[model samples]
Target: MPKWPDDDVILFDGVCIFCSRWVRFIAKRDTAKRFRFTPIQSDYGARLARTFGIDPNDPDTNAVVHRGEAFLQSDAALTVLSHLPGWSWTRALLAVPKPLRNAVYGLIARNRYRIFGKYDACFVPDADLRARVIE
Candidate 1:
């Protein structure tokens, strides 16, 4: 088995503006730098999505891979938040129940492009943050 990096990776929709903002949000809050980012369109991102049985062409769910385990959708989002300093409070949302949380997430995801719009191509991280991105 491949030994993945110790830092968590968030695989997201590269063209989605909202997703890009979320990535930036995590980057800002991740003072410990525990997370790295890879856009779903990237070669590595596509491979990971395929390995996890997700459709790479129409990748809909955001995923977080930590310690070789993958968390998808709402669980992934919550897990990422829980790791950030002072953001453990977001984990309190776990009490809301999984199905309900996922439903809301799904709704936003389905309309994300329509609501937040999208980029012509995958976003490129700034030079200072380049080290935290995996192509």
Candidate 2:
């Protein structure tokens, strides 16, 4: 079981450049310690994905499970941002059509490695942040 609270967990693509940066971004400001994370590439992530009917092999699909309900991709990102402090204001982006939002998200994701950056391994949260990794 995840050490972090189950309802606040977010499972992401560990290998994706965008996802890795996102993990760091989220870790920096979760001041209230209200969120948790893991890579969809992990065993727990795989199980959670299956529970939500998400395809494990699809890197474009992101997942956020809250109270047993799951959000996907753009929805997942919006769901996460909704709970974040300053970022919560961006939840309005969720009102945009999924296809449109995902199209933009996809463009970035497709070129994430080139546009952003990547890491050789999953992030290991520091002593204070370790609880947020959910592993």
Candidate 3:
């Protein structure tokens, strides 16, 4: 039972180009600085993933830990969007149905490496971006 962060924390596949890009997208839109990030390759992120029953070594979904609650897959994406300024409208996707949303998320997650390619190593954010990353 590791203590979750006070702010919203996103756990993503560090080696996935698409996932890293999504993190950058959220960071750019999150002017309020309400979100923090952790790559699943990190120790803390791995523990969190395991707690949620997500395999860290072969993760098929991203996660968002917001206000002590953890959201997985499509729910996690929607949750992150809702917190971003001007991005709350994306929450409308929630009406699409959880199973459908998760199915789509799963498809993307399963093919992410093949479709978007992977980094040889986990992304290492620069000093400026590192401020928002939770080790």
Clashes of each: 0, 0, 0
lDDT per residue as tens, model 2, 2-94: 222368678887777778778778777777877678787788887777777666667667777766577777887888888878987888897
Candidate 2 is scored at a TM of 0.80
Instruction: Write the number of the candidate with greater TM-score, choosing between 1 and 3.
Output: 3
Clashes of 1: 0
Better of 1 and 2 by TM-score: 1
TM-score of each: 0.93, 0.80, 0.94
> Which candidate has the top score in lDDT?
3
Model 3 ranges with Cα > 4 A deviation? 1-6
Most TM-score-accurate candidate: 3
Each prediction's Cα RMSD?
A: 2.0, 3.8, 1.8
lDDT of 2: 0.74
**Model 2 worst lDDT window (10 residues):** 1-10
Residue range with the least summed lDDT across 10 consecutive positions in model 1: 1-10
- Off-target runs (Cα >4 Å) in candidate 2 are 1-5
